[model samples]
Target chain A: MSLSIFLITLAFIILLQAAIPFLLKRSIAFGVTIPEQHMKERALSSYKRFYSATILITGTLALTVYLLWAKNRTLSEDQVVFAGLAIQFGVLFLSMIMYLYFHVKTTKLKRTHKWGAGLKQVRIADLASHAKDEMLPSYMFALPALITAGLLVYTASQYSQLPAMIPTHWDIAGQPDAFSRKTPFSTISLLLILLVIQGMMFGINVMTKRSGIKLTSAKKKASQIQQLAFRKYSSWFLFLTTVLITILFGFIQLVIIQGGMGNAAFMAAMPLGFLLIMLIVTAIYAFRVGQGGSRIKVTVEDEEAMETAFVDDDQYWKAGIFYVNKNDPSIFVEKRFGVGWSINFGNPIGYIFLLVSILLIVLISFFS
Target chain B: MLIQIETSSDIPIYTQLSNQLIELIARGQLKGGDVLPSVRSLASDLGVNMHTVNKSYHELESKGIIRIVPKSGAVINPSIRDGISDEHRLRIVEELKPIIAEAIVLGMTAKEIQHLASSILSDMKEE
Candidate 1:
């Protein structure tokens, strides 16, 4: 792959990734699970249709902007990649503003609808004893650890062949932008990142498996099944990301070793493409399934529950967004208006975690 | 065991929690030595205040339905199976007094009230 090809591919991959959560929001009816009777109504409703249309329109505009930007044949390959990335981010920002406005409006609209009213009383359900055991093979958790160890060993064994000075960093166009002596500290940053990410993923999986799941009820069995499926999907997401990280790191190691057999660009493309394709696929899956298996079909349990008993928790939901119920000791809860989870700002520990996490991210970005 | 807390009930949250937990023990859904979820966990699960759950746990401990060990979470007491005392009998009667009065006010026959009590007991027994 040439530099131009890589840049365009990377741009599209990122735009797609950024667009996914919004796309998935359309499939979901205000971030709640799809009840069988409400399935068509939810899908066909103006909220979903408008959101879907907006996503399509935003995506088309983003691509057109990229194509038009790419027309600047006078620009260097590096400039092209940089410009493409900037455009994606700009387009994504606009799309996000549109989503936030419409998403809040849609959520409020849902409150007046029967399906929304009936799906209230959102409570967490305990994980069935078998859920964790059944979701994925236990061995899958060890894959990242094993791969990391293997890569470390392999890199160490090739140290003799590695040049005294190695390229520590590369620009977006597969060209070396920074160099350092062939030391573990210089070349092993990616490995460290991978390990940290793996640890985080492990923590997440354990938490999900042990913690109670949020359910829109009257369908206990189906909801439990859906929770389990979501857990399974989460595992796959972790596995794929781990694989991508390993490839990119391994690619770096190869560049440091044999200089990629004189096909640097081509060698980089394989792993980069693999990573991008995985991201695109994951985004598509998220779009179709929504968060926490919202769109997965199962037999709707006929048993009726107090579905109409909507908890008037708006006060607890601080600023109508961040959940700040000091009484709720849970560290995490399903996000009220989006796919995935949010940390409870109520629990003292949870509050601390949120603050520390934000601080760490900011500090890292600034220093890096 | 499945335990439910009615969020919309007029009764106080702690009182409702204690009552439901006691009922669970009565029906054998929660057995002797069966550990309940930690106070924090249950409060989080029910989306209620932790102090409310703490109060409920204390109430159960006072009644001898569940024990709150220093480090361990609440556990149902084996002594829950022990027969009631004269005090307990008096307490039960005292608790039922208002309802009995209401039944009388509503013009329900004594036989009908007796049947209602019997039906509830039978349902609990089946569980």
Candidate 2:
């Protein structure tokens, strides 16, 4: 089971890397903005093909080598896990390098060709979109917190019957590898961490609601519909993931509280199931909705009027990845190269958010 | 309602924003009591400086087209039926004076100007 999981994870990573080009907004290719008319250029298609083929070939070769090592049984289970991680990171690094290569090549090509020179450059905002009842209500997230609280109460009531030492670490086989003296803190720590994570999830939902909707001028009405749909579906995805994570953590807490009495395979399967569900759901969401709802289908009546070029602000995007615009007050903007939003590094609020998240992770780790 | 900003336009960003918003209001697309997006929200949505959107909101408020409530947001004011005040009428004439002069210099007839104004008015009411 572990071997299969490792192989499946590696395959997923490689495919996802190759699929990155497809997942980006149609206006953006390899982190560079392309005019609608230039998107179908032969050179661009060849570049995309070369990038994907290179990543696939290199990643598959590495995975095959790892498979051979794993099958030889010369390496321990821990080494097998580490080797799988190394391979995944190796592929990821290769893909990043290739992406930058294409980004530079595309930028150079666009510069020489003047892809959108003649078109009017414009940005659009929909005032009424904010008023739309699109987001999942904040109160809905409170359900998971309520469940955690219930578990906390149960833990308190059963404190006397709990083991003196509780498992704090588990191995691949679900055997307890480390333990800490049972105290009220250790007993309820996981529940507390779960609560904090759930709160963060709630915060993310609120941020999504307030994040600016960037409409593509190439298809104003269609882009508007797509943005709304993107916001709606992404928020729902977040809420559902929050619920699933809360349940997974709750199960772990229950097992720890009960002195690790659950079956070994079941215990191991819980987290694996959580990861599998999350990956599958995210892949499906990205495929269906796309970055900024670029994949969503919509029709507009006056296509000619909306044919303005998407404003070329490539200067703001450093390497087609990090967005650093001092003049742009937006805290979050849709990423140019990938799915979902990225922080505007020029905004001080982005740094504050990053620091707070790091602090939360530290707190969770310290307590655990 | 959608408000578009042309970065390369000769008009400043804030003026463009205020102009488009006023046009929306004049067309009744943004009705009385409708709350405009907050400065930060609109600025971020248009990817411009917050001061730009703030300037536009203040311009609208100065023109009495909207009232900015500190907490809630900028709300469109109900249209008043009373004819323009003398000062306001004079200000309108001062603003239109240059455009009318230019039209005349460009060989546009007075009747053609009247027809243009009426056509624009009808176009607004059409929607």
Task: Estimate TM-scores for all models.
Answer: 0.78, 0.95
Candidate 1 C-alpha lDDT tens digits along B1-127: 4445556556787887777778877887767887887776666557777798899899888776788887877877885346788877887899899999999999999999999999999999997
Q: Tens digit of lDDT per residue, candidate 1, span A1-368?
A: 33455455645544453444444423244444333455566434665556556656766666666666667566776676676666656665665665567556655555556444444344433422243434455456667777777777877787677777777566555667766666665555555555665655555555444334544445556656665676567666666776676766666666666754636576456666875677576665666555566667778664665545433455566433477767666666655554455666766665564465456545543333
Any residue pairs clashing in model 2, and if so which? none
For all the models shown, what interface RMSD does each have? 3.6, 0.9
For model 1, the docking class works out as acceptable
Off by over 4 Å in 2: A299-302, B106-112
Residue-wise C-alpha lDDT for candidate 2, range A16-52, written one tens digit per residue: 7887787767678888888888888888888889998
- For candidate 1, the TM-score is 0.78
lDDT of 1: 0.61
Local distance difference test, each candidate: 0.61, 0.84
Name the regions of candidate 1 deviating beyond 4 angstroms.
A1-44, A68-72, A107-143, A146-162, A181-184, A254-263, A305-307, A311-321, A347-368, B68-72, B78-82, B102-109
Interface RMSD of 1: 3.6
